[model samples]
Each structure stands twice: as structure tokens, then as C-alpha cells.
Target: MSNIQQLPSRQVSNRGMEGGRRSLCRFLMPLSFPWVLLWVLALGGLVLMPGAVLAEVPNAVPPEGTYEGEHVEQPIEFPHDTHADVNKINCMYCHTYARRSPVAGIPPTSKCMGCHSIIATDKPRIKQLTEYWDKRQPPPWKKVHDVPDFVHFTHEKHLKRFVFDNEGMDVENVAEVCAFCHGEVKKMTVANKVKPLTMGFCRRCHEANDGPFDCWKCHK
Candidate 1:
């Protein structure tokens, strides 16, 4: 009878060991090769998805290349630095047609007199401007950034894409967009063509920004 009781105890211990082994196998089953591989692929997809999304998003990367253009002389030696940088005047405030027209038209004589009629009347440049205003004549402001006649470029479309329609761009920083082709005017008293506005220069920028490549897109 004692032998029989010892046999029952041994059987009970064996059953418990078998149950523990089954529980351990159940816990480790999910970590098997196929399941682990699926998890790894899922994690890799998560890691790479953001990069793909970001690549598709547009950004303001200025064009490259420079040219030493001749110093253009204007009727009144207007200080662009003084108005744009020091006084913090917006470029659009003076060149208002840039947002709606093909060309960024020069500001009228009235626009100049609107401010200089009172402010800084004593300065020599201001005095010169006053003389023009008194004579009721517009200062013959020469164009610094003139593109080829064959090129069908529009300031309105470009500004809309880069400034108004751009997701994160601010209207206050429009000078940066202007600098892409016009150079940094805020630092210069007189505007100069510091960029190589050639076909290659334009093509490189278009390629970089994923712009339209069709010939008629730019050519008339």
C-alpha cells in the first residue's frame, strides 16, 4: 500500500511539470521566426514612412548661381536698405502688383510722395525726390531684374505658389523668395542683378523644385 501511494505522488509531480512546460511554450510561441519577421517588417515600414512623406512635401530652397551685373543707375538714388531693412517696410508695400500681375510694376510717384511728402524732407536724397514730386514727374526707375522677352514668367503665379499657397511660409518673409533671382536687395542701397538669370540657371532651379519641364511652360 505504501508503494502504491508513492507511485500516485510521482504521477501528480510529472503532470505538474508537463503543465508548466506547456505554459512556457505558449508564452514563447509569438516570438517564433515567422511572427518576429512580420513584426520587424512592420517596424521598418513605420520608420521609413515619414521620410517618404516628407520628400513629397514642398519647401523654399533658393536657386543657385551668381552674375556680376553692371551697376544700374536710377534718377533718384533710392536707399532700399533704409526703407526695407532699417524702417522694416515690406517689399509688397512698394511693389504691390507682384501678387496679381505678370510683372512687378514700379511704384508710382504718388507712392513715394505719400511718405516723403513729410518724412525725411531734410535729407539730400529726399530733397531730390521732393524736386521730382514738386514738378509732378515720376522718377524714371530703371529695371534691375529684367528677364528675356521670350520667357513667359509671371510674378503672380510664383508668389502664389511660394508665399500664399505654401503651407508654412509667411507673407512677411517674401524678400527671401525675391532673393532667389534678384539677390539680397535689403543689404544694398541700389538694386543690382547679382544672379545669373540664364537658361541653365533657370533649368537647374526648375529641376530642383520639381517645376514644369515642358518647353511652352516658360517659352512663348
Candidate 2:
């Protein structure tokens, strides 16, 4: 009789153990469902996002000083080759005081009239320049090669070092060195940022020249 009673107690304990195991599986099922779902969603996102980004890439660099951004073509196509290359007008002819000032100064209307008044008074560009002058405003010649204002670049220092000759060096003929930073003006029609002026790009050249490799010099 005692053995029979003990057998019923053992069966009850076994049933409780089975019940606990079933409860554990039930608890884990909910947790595992979300974990499996998250992995699937993450993998799907990784596969899809890159194709979308690649499809959105642009052709040319944008204005307002973005290195990799895109731009719509300008309203008026100002061909630099015609004005600077063929005509042999120096860069300082339009952008005067590039050697003296921190700003590569854009010319006022009076400066344009020095040539336009005689060269092509009837041309639309000349007319536009004149109109701006009449209003005491300068043409907003959109800046293509703009470093940010925080970067205090002095044209005076660089020109004094590289351009002005001391004795017989003859200034390295820097007018021909337009391709160094500003790419070939010979081929450009509408102005664009020709170089990627990233930190890595600047460092590579600075390292070559044995120049001061200070981030504060450019980044300020």
C-alpha cells in the first residue's frame, strides 16, 4: 500500500516537471519571434539602402562650396577659355588683387567697362554688367572655388613666397600654374569646383612640399 501511494506522488512530480518545461518553451517562443524578425528586417534594409543611394548620385559638383554635391547648370554660360585663354587676359584682369588681398576680388562694373565699352557694348553680358553698375550693384558672379570663411587663406603670403621673384628665379611663371588648384581654364566653360578639397586631399599635397602640416592653418 505504501509503494502504491509513493507511485502516485512520483507521477504527480513528473507531471509538474513536464508542465514547467512546456511553460519555459511558451515563454521563450515570444522572445525568439521578435529576435528572428529583427534580423530579417536588418538584413533587408542593408541590401536595399545602397542601391537607392547609388541611383541618387549626380554628375557635377554643386555651388556654395560642397565638394561632392550636384548643381544645375548656370543661367548664363560664361566661357573662361574665350575670356582668359584665347583673349590672353590675365586672371588678375577680372579677379584683381588676388596677390594682395585675402579675397580674390571680383571686378566692379567700371573695371568691366574698361574693356566692354570698347570690345562688345551690344553683347548681352556687357549689357547686364552695365545695368548692375547703373544700380550701384556689382554682378553676383557666383563663386565656384570657395573655401569657407573660417579658413583664413592669405593670397599676399602665398604670392610673396611663390610669385614675386627675388633675383633671377622669375616668379616660377605662375600664370601658367592655373592647373595646380584651379584646374585647366582652357577647357572650362561654366565654372565648377574641379578638385576635391577634402582634408585628405590637402594633407597629401602639404606632405609633399614639406610645408606646415597644421590642421588649424586650413580649418582654423
Candidate 3:
């Protein structure tokens, strides 16, 4: 009688453990197999694609070496903070061509010396600007702020459509507009790409304001 009772209890215990093990395996098999596949796919992706799977893998170009884009830098660092921030000058005063022209003309040294001739003669920065004028050569200020050659952008149309002589508002005038695209000049000693000036970047703003974003608008 004791053996019979024990036999029934032992059978139940064995079945219960087997069920538990199967349940655990059921949970683990799917989870474990997928994990291995994930590692494989991740390895494959790195070897086959864009991120850090094979971090040591060299890029199409070497990661550490000199690279030169088309854009060039100015000879002297012209701080926008001093002129725009301190002097409260108009933007059109220098980039005087913006109102009706396709090209926003760089200020000739003569234009600069017209003021620097009196205000700060001793600064080596001003001295160079003066030298440019005396030589009849405008400072060979490189065009730092530019879009792709494919894009035919114009200061004339943008100002006519959106910006103008609204003096009180800081960002509405040409000087302010310069700050918008070029960034706060008074602060920059050397003009740099403050804006990424990419196609997507241009398109985002164009769509927002219903501005003309056609590739033809910039690329001539």
C-alpha cells in the first residue's frame, strides 16, 4: 500500500519538473537563437555598412589626415561684434550691392578706410586694410559664405521678397540678414560657415515660408 501511494506521487513530481523544463526551454530557445542572430547581423552590418561594428575599419578616406574643401578663410579676423554690436552700422553700408544685384559685393578697402582712416589707424588689422586700398586692391577677402555652384542664389530677390529697410528689428535689415546667414559678425574674427548651407537645410526654411526652393532658384 505504501509503495502504491509513493509511485503515484513520484510520477506527478517528475511530470511537473519536465513541464517546468520545457516551459523554460520554450522561453529560452526563441530568446537565445534570436540573440545569436542579432550578434551576427550586427557584425554583418558593420562589415557591410555605416556605423561602428568594425571601428578599426578604415573609411573610404583616411579618418585622420588633412582635408581641404573649396572654401577659403580671410586674412584677418574681422569681429562682427565690434562693428555690428558696438557701432550699430547698417549692413547695406558694406555689402552695398545687395539691393538690386545678383552678387553681394565685398566692401572694397576704400570703403573700409573711409571709416578706419579715422577710427582706428594703429591696429595692424586696419593697417592691412589700408594697404589694400593704397594698392587699389580690395582685401582679397575670400568668399566664405556660399552655396553650391549649382545653386543660383541672389541677395536681391531674398531682400525684395522678405527682408528690407525695417530698421528697428535686428534681424530684418541687411546687416541683420547677414547675421542670419553669416551669423553674428561682431563676434567672429574670421568668417566661417555658421550655417551648414546644405540642400536639406535650405529646403526646410523654403517650405516653411513658401519661398522658392527650386534647384533653379540658386543654380544658374
Candidate 4:
């Protein structure tokens, strides 16, 4: 009788342990389902569509600058190579303020229409420029190069110091002066930032050219 009772007690305990294990499995299944599904999807994507998965990767590194190496949507697709290199049009012809002021201002729509009105009159891009001119609205030109707000870099000073005073240098065109900082714009279909334009880059150029190194020289 005693042996029989002990056997029954062991059977009940074993059943209780089995029941607890089943409860634990039920509780954990819902919690782990989403993670398991995600891993399965990722693995499936890698096996089935590797190129698509790689192309749509969320954490891919972005290219430097706001406009550099980017196909920026614009009101007009102005070809720099055609204007600056082919036609031999000067950079100052459009950006007139570069000689006198800190900013290299964008040409007004009228200035664009001045040439497009006669040249390339049949082209669709010229037609777009004409429409903007007729409406008297400025083309929403996005700036390619951006300097820090705190740093005060004037185009006038650099022009005076480097281009005019240094007679021995081969800097004849205003475009060459611009090419010192901005890369060869005459060759590009769209202007892009080639230089990193950081403080370190500026300091290295200043030190090489014997420009001012004082903290306030640029920072102010």
C-alpha cells in the first residue's frame, strides 16, 4: 500500500512539472513571434532578392554636402559646361557680386532670359526660363556651397589678395580664382562641392598662402 501511494505521488508531480513547462512555452511563444518573423524575412530577402535587399538598406552612408554629387531638382537645368567652357562666358557675367561682395549672388531670371531669349530659343529648358521671366518670379535657386554662419569669408578679400596682388601667379580669369575653392565649374554639367570646406582645409590653405591665421580672421 505504501509503495503504491509513493508511485501515485511521483506521477502527479511529474504531470505538474509537464503542465508548468507547457504554460511557460505558451507565454514565451507570443513574445518571440515578431523577432522570429523579422529574422525569417531578412534571411528570405537575402536568399531570394539579394540586390533588392542591399539597394533598400536603411542605414547606408549618405554622400557629403547638400548638393554635391546629387541630382538636385531645379526650375532650369543650366549646363555650366556649355556656358562657361563652350561659349567662354565668364563666371562674373552671372555672379556679378563676387568681385564686390562676400556673396557670389545668383543671376536673376531676367539675366537668364537675356541669353535664352535669343540662344537656344527652341529648346524646352529655354522655354521654361522664358515662362519664369514672363511671370517676374525668381528661379528658386538652391545654394551649392555653404560656409558656417560664424565664419566671415569674403570673396572680395581673397580676390584682392590672391588674384590682383600676386602678379607672378597664373590666375588670369575670375573663374580661376573661384576654382581655387570651388572645383572646375567649367567642366561640370552641374556644380558640385569637391573640397571638404572644413576649418582644417581653410587653415591649411591660409598657412600655405600666408593668409591671416588669427582666430578672429575667419571666426569673426
Candidate 5:
């Protein structure tokens, strides 16, 4: 007489189902604990310190170091201080293509005339500009911040990063961002290359600001 006890079919089915549930729980246990802990901590943080969670990440500090650039003579000495500092004009008002194009394009004669024709027609600088306008000739503005041919800089992209995409930054104060490389144009008569704009200078800034490490980003 075999002594082995046979379970009823119904009881066997229930036991098998319970064993399957135990197997499933064992498989999921490892993954579930960490995820559940993460959720709990995240919820706790949101409830206890909502401001820290919601606050915008502050922008990186601006780069430093200065260079004594040679004076660049332009056809007409543009009064940057009068326009940018005194009048509180936005940098993009004149450098209109900065937000859309690669270069912060030199303002056309028409743009100068739009203001000089009515604002300060008697000023010698304005008179010189008027002469150029009369002759329908561009003033052959010399670039003050020219980079090396190997450098691949785009004003539009820089502007988009430091101005447009930055949270808690106001567009009206775009000159502050412009000052990163161009220096304080609001204090000068003409733009000068105050920042070194050297490879090391740029690399240091990139490292500080979480910019790309790839050399191809800036070098052609």
C-alpha cells in the first residue's frame, strides 16, 4: 500500500496558482524596491522642498580675462555709449541678424539713415553717414572682433543659447550676454576686442559652461 496522499484536483489547481504568484513576486522584487524607493523620495522632495525642485538652474558664470586690442578706425566713429548705454537701446536693434544669422551683421546704411535722418543730422558723424547715404555707398565698416578663418563661430547660435534659451533671463538685457566676448560696448565709442578670443580662452569658457568637448565644434 503506497502511503503517498493525493491532493484533490481543485486544491492542486489552487496550489499551482499560488506557486506561480510566488514565482512572479520573486522575479519582480528586485526591480520594484529601487523604483518604489525612488518614487517615495521624489514625492517626499516635492512635498518638502518644492521650490528647490521647481527653481531654474542658474546660468554659468561669464568668462574673464582682457586684452589690449589695437584701435580699429572705422569710416564713421559710431557712438556705442550714446546709443546702447544712454538711450538703453538693445544690441539686436542694430545687429538685427544676430538672432537669425551666423554673423552679427553690420548695420546697413539704410538702418543708420532711418535714425540719423531725424535724430542728429547736424552731428559730424551723422553728416559723414549722410554723405555715404547720398552716394549710395556702404561705409566699409571694419570688423573689430574678427576670428581666425579656422574658427567656426555663429552669433545666432550663441545668442540663442545665452539669450533665448536661458531661463529667467530678459531679452532687454542681452548686452550683458554680448559682453561675454565683445566686452562692454555700452561704455565705448567703437567696439574693441577686449576679450582674448584665443583658443585657450574659449576652451576654458566651454569647460566651465558645459560646452562641447569636441574640437570640431569650434575648429574647422
Candidate 6:
């Protein structure tokens, strides 16, 4: 009778040990087989490839880097926070033609030197700007917010119509209007594009705002 009882007890212990081994194996199998991870990644990439291709239009560059949560190396480390936030300088102070013209023309070197020539002359960034001013050359500033070549967007129309008249906002004084699409320029050390500025985004905004949806409005 005692031997029979010992046999049942031993069988129960063996079953428990087998169960524990199976649980550990189940946990470790995926990690031990790295090819499983690779196969999953490959399958995901194949699934994602078509959407990635469709997201971008042909001959048009997508908005990315810096303000789009990516970093870009700029020629001059111009801090927008210092100029816009600390100094309380308006956007038109540098981007002069934002109100009157279609293109908010890049500020000439003279505009920068207007203050920088005397102010912070000892600083390296000021020295760099001074060099460019002296040479009469533009500071090779990289274009940040570029629309599709086919799309004809005018700054003056937006400022005059949607921003001031329709939106009941000020001219260039309203940071929120600009920041709606350009991100918070006053907080950035480097200027970057925040909005995708895609046609679909523009169309949605137009539909919401009851603005013109004609092809000629944007597409040239």
C-alpha cells in the first residue's frame, strides 16, 4: 500500500516539472529564433511599402526634417527664440514682404546687419553674418517650407483674405495664424517645416473654411 501511494506521488511531481518546462520553452522560443523577428519585420515592410509610395506625389518632395520631428544641419545657427521671443521681433521684420507680396522674400544680409552689425559683434554667429554681409553674398539659407512645383501659393492672398478679413485677425502680428501651419517659430532654435502642406490638407481646410476649391486656386 505504501509503495502504491509513493508511485502516484512521483507521477504528480513529474507532471508538474513537465508543465514548468513547457511554460519556459513557450516563453523562450521566439527570442531563441531570431529569424521569426526578421520574418515579421519583412512582412511589415512589404505591407507598408505601397502606402509609403502613395503618400508622396511624383516630382514633389515631402515635408520632413527638423520641425517635422527630425534634425537638419543649418548653415547658420540662427535662434528664432532669441530673435522672436526674447527680442519680440515680428515675422515681417525679417521676412519683409509677407503682407504685400506673394513671396515673403528672404531678408537681405543688410537687414540682419542692421542690428547684428553693432550688437553681439563678438559672437561667432554675428561674425559669420558679418562675413556674408561684407562679401555681399546670401547666406545659402536652405528653403524650409517648399510646396509642390505645380502648386502656386501666394502669401499675400492668405494674409489678406483668410488671415485678416475672414479669420478676423491682424496682419502679420498674429502668431497663431502663422503658427497654425508653420509651427511655433518663437520656440524653435532652427526654422523647420511643421505642416505636411499636402494638397489633401489644403483641400480639407478649404472645405471647412468655405474657401475656393478651384484647381486654379492652388494648381498652376
Residue 159 error for model 1, in Å?
A: 0.5
Question: Which 10 consecutive positions of candidate 3 have the poorest summed lDDT?
Answer: 57-66
Where does candidate 3 stray beyond 4 Å? 1-72, 165-173
- Return the TM-score for candidate 3, rounded to 2 decimals: 0.60
Total clashing pairs in model 2: 0
Candidate 3 vs candidate 4, lDDT winner = 4
TM per prediction: 0.72, 0.59, 0.60, 0.65, 0.73, 0.66
lDDT (0 to 1) per candidate = 0.78, 0.56, 0.59, 0.66, 0.78, 0.66
Candidate 2 structure quality by residue, lDDT tens digits, 106-143? 67668877877788778886777677778888666677
lDDT of 4: 0.66
Off by over 4 Å in 5: 1-58
Provide the lowest-lDDT 10-residue window in model 6: 57-66
lDDT of model 6 at residue 131? Answer: 87
How do the residues 67-172 of candidate 4 rate in per-residue lDDT, one tens digit apiece? 2345565667778999988888888889888778998889877788787878889998788778878888887877778898998999878777765565554333
Q: What local lDDT score does residue 49 receive in model 3, on the 0 to 100 scale?
A: 82
Candidate 2 off by > 4 Å:
1-76, 165-173
Model 2: weakest 10-residue lDDT segment is 56-65
Off by over 4 Å in 4: 1-69, 168-172
Clashes of 3: 11
Model 6, 8-97: lDDT tens per residue? 322322344457768966865776468677767877998788523222222222222112435567779889999887888888778878
lDDT at residue 96 of model 3 (Cα atoms): 85
Give candidate 1's whole-model lDDT: 0.78
For residues 5-99, could you state the per-residue lDDT of candidate 3 as single tens digits? 22322232234445766886675566577777886787697788842221221111111111123435677667666776577667677778988
